[model samples]
Target: MAESHIDLGVVTAPSGVLVLGMASWIDHWPQLGGTLSERARASASIGGGHVHDWMCEMVAVRAAGDRPLTVRAGTAKSPLDGGPTIATLEIDLGIPWVRTAGNEPIILGDLPVDRCGMVLGDALALDSWTGDGHPSTDGLADVTYWGAHAEAAHRQFGGELIPGRGNQVRGWLDLPLDDAKSLGDALGDWTGDEQGRGVMVAVDEHNDFHSFNRASRTHPLLIGAIEVADCPVLGINWDSGDHSMRHRGERPFGQVYPVTLQPDRTGRTTMRWTIPPYAPGHDGPE
Candidate 1:
């Protein structure tokens, strides 16, 4: 049988349901090589403010009313690279069901009023904006700092699945670098579990201010392996340095060898990700 595929773009149902994923226009795309104020103003512009540029592991859907939902495992290609399948998930949304057969089924209505954020027959929505005023990125160019903020937002807004919530967790973790040697030692000591989990280590590389931003002296470097189980789409900036995704085991998965920035390219750097061939245990593209 042919494999199924889900449209990663914005999806809506006739029942007043709206679904927004990473591909949806949620936030403004940051411009490359400009003053913080200039960048902010450019982002606020209509054409500049919103773009489908984020690459993520998870897919978020907003459902409405008491209508049931159906989710199926399928392959989605990254619009950034247009290369290979990124990730697949299998889930079904329907009448309340129990995972185990023996345990007494819990009643949905019996749940506490405060806990039942999404009551039946109510519309569901997700607002990406936190409503907090944008912070100054003036002297800050560290990707880790931004990643930390993203993680914090996810936690503060009650996780990614909560309806009407503003934040979605991207699973960004920080690896403290104790010293110069620690960087090498950490890479050499990476474990199989980490590889299977598809963790990427980002290193800062120096670059010209024109290439990126005045505050940022270096481009972002990403290293490690990627798989369908991990973040399917690995986001990258246009001026980002060379990145490597190496697999340890015999089996092959999504891996980007080395993607370097091209100085000739002009305008804002478009968010991008390299797609690899679909691996075992993942659904192939239709």
Candidate 2:
């Protein structure tokens, strides 16, 4: 008797990989095995060349023979631009998993697998991520590594980034193009996944925050509103100086800053801050 393989389903995207949270439950799921796995081709807009494709396999050992297989694939329409492909698979496991794969100009979702790859080949082409130690196997540091590259790409192209609330309070903030780069740099390299990178870009870029909660991973703080003096306010927001979320004390609540771009010590661009006296624990001018 020959081994039987099921046509689980296929997901198509521009460039990013869509991992459907299989590793979490599949238990040592095959990086290249699985009855659900198969070969897939990406539909790029251009022609005159061979169509690129990738392996979409599910390890045979991990296949759940007792349960029925269900696969759903489709494109998530965006309010602004085209979105990435989303495919959900339910093969006995109760957990909900969706997969997507594609390149650039395609918006990524908040799935762990999606975040694992970050925006490596798409927006930011970092050689390091392509080499080895993928985030899925290497762990958190790898996630941060990919995140830094993705954030760098977003920095080059101005935008907003709103992450899922995930136990933290949520809100929104609008940033000016000029201020976006400076503030991103001053905040240091971003340290989240593709979802985090999505949250970092503003609405103008592609509104990647769609469906995901509008919040911050560290501490949820919104600027609410602000009024600056003679200096035109380039941007406004609750500057939570500490993104590490290490501070246990009552955070500097309502600490608003008038955003502006300025040259850092290295003569490179950075965000310059203008603190107000009324701000919590604000010590007057130096």
- The prediction achieving the highest TM-score against the true structure is 1
How high is the CA lDDT of each candidate model?
A: 0.24, 0.23
Worst 10 residues of 2 by lDDT: 227-236
Identify the leading candidate in terms of lDDT: 1
Per-residue lDDT of model 2, residues 133-154, tens digit only: 1222111110011233544545
lDDT of 1 by residue, 1-286 (tens): 2334543221122233222222112122222233222332333232212112232111222232244333222444333343223233222222233233443322111110010011111012222211112332222211111132344333442222322112332221222323323443443244334333312333332211111221212211111111111111112122111112212211123222211111112321111112233344432112
lDDT of 2: 0.23
Q: How close is candidate 1 to the true structure, as a TM-score?
A: 0.21
Angstrom error at residue 282, model 1: 24
Instruction: Kindly provide the TM-score of model 2 when superposed on the true structure, using C-alpha atoms.
Output: 0.18
